[model samples]
Target: MKRLRYIALGVMVALLAWGYVAFNHWQREMIFMPSRAVGHTPPNGSFSDQWIDAPAAGGVEGGKVHAWWLPAASPEAPALLYLHGNADTLSTNVAAIDRLRQAGFAVLAIDYRGFGASAALLPEERSAYADARAAWQRLEQLAPRAVKRLAYGHSLGGAIAVELAATTPRVDGVVVEGSFTSVVDVAKSTEFDWMPLSLVVSQRFASDEKVAALKTPKLFIHCARDEVIPLRFGDRLYEQAGEPKSRLVIPGGDHNDCPAAAAGEWRDTLRRFGGISA
Candidate 1:
């Protein structure tokens, strides 16, 4: 009996140690699911090619990051810096990009580090922000005369967009779709709630904190039926934001299709926040 007890104790300790190591190693993979291939194409060849140089950093390769610039129907239309989510490439946003363009706004959509054709080997919180900054700088150079500048992000990109809007002085407005309050909050809401994610998770895209600092006009869009990042997260973010904020709850919409499902309302909200007509 004594010998059997010692063996069981040893096995339990080994399993706990293994679990700790495994969780730390795979946390990023759980958060960011990036794909290497372009999933869709721009409409009618209306977009131009863009690239920005990633800054040197630990675990980052520091190379050119690819982007696509879709011109607005009108020259004086506002411009939007579109930050994509964790999965797939910017090509996955073809429908959203086209919709924004049709709404009379120039759009610059970028792939973060370790995503699509970007040069970083792996993407973390800081590196993703750096890549977004580089893309914004390039967009400024491309459209120096744009009437206004806006930031739009979806899912994981929403957190990045909020950070950019908070830090960038030139941003006129901000928009986030299906975004969470923070990585820790998300971990608590999911199956990993039992784990101490605060100690293990490295990517802290804390939009909740960033949103409080943003004075720009803001819009929070979420789907009531979203299973990935619950609608309450969006509500929490919207509630934390300062004045001149709006919220759009899309009924019966899921994570990815909310924009398409409520295209009219989405465009109207963007126009109202961006000070654009029609």
Candidate 2:
């Protein structure tokens, strides 16, 4: 069976090559360049904000990270600490910020390390968690009298928000949109199954693992036709989370349009969850 032996050897070599390439990709992803943060340079604008710098998570060697603080329409409004997706800058999230502001809440959106005005560094799950904590601490110092603080994250940002909510009791409510259950789950479903992501995904966002531990009210929004992160991931996350959670599914909406499509519904949903009157 010499031919059979050769085939087996070839398969083993192919698998090895795949594993190596996947690992390299993972390493590169860990070091992905952070996008430049865009903002409205305004003397006659919708809103004005100031940037604040703080230490990067995990004690990484770098200057302090950066975040933006946009005051609410009024001082009595609640505040939102927002985390953006992998490729997004704070200005990219201005629409949602506007929405939340219309709903009467101040917003603080921060770029992760290596992103926008923040320091450059490889992003890891724990690192993002630490950065989130730093943002809250900075906000407390900036606005001492603020009553409520909420967390809203989309895609990769959702993973960040979930980790913070599960571990930190100070978060009043959490909104995770277009999030996945885990990186492995996503890899397994994609063409990258040959990568063995389940084995090497070190910074596993592992949203499912922490969902049950979250005690605060959570709102999970997903698009039924989402092609980037399948709707099933959100479904799985929902099934794993504890009480005081709600899932909103937008039919026929893809990943990017979910917010726009469900704008009214999103406002209503967050209002109910945050106990804010519309």
Which one is best on TM-score?
1
Give the TM-scores of the predictions, in the order they appear.
Answer: 0.88, 0.83
What is every candidate's alpha-carbon RMSD to the true fold? 4.7, 5.9
Best candidate, lDDT: 1
Give candidate 1 regions above 4 Å deviation.
Answer: 1-25
What is the alpha-carbon lDDT for the whole of candidate 1?
0.83
**Candidate 1 C-alpha lDDT tens digits along 189-267:** 7788997777777778998887776888888999999988888898898898887788999887789888788888877
Tens digits of lDDT, candidate 2, 56-131 = 5444544455666767656656788888787777666766666776776777778776677676666656667777
Collision pairs in model 1: none
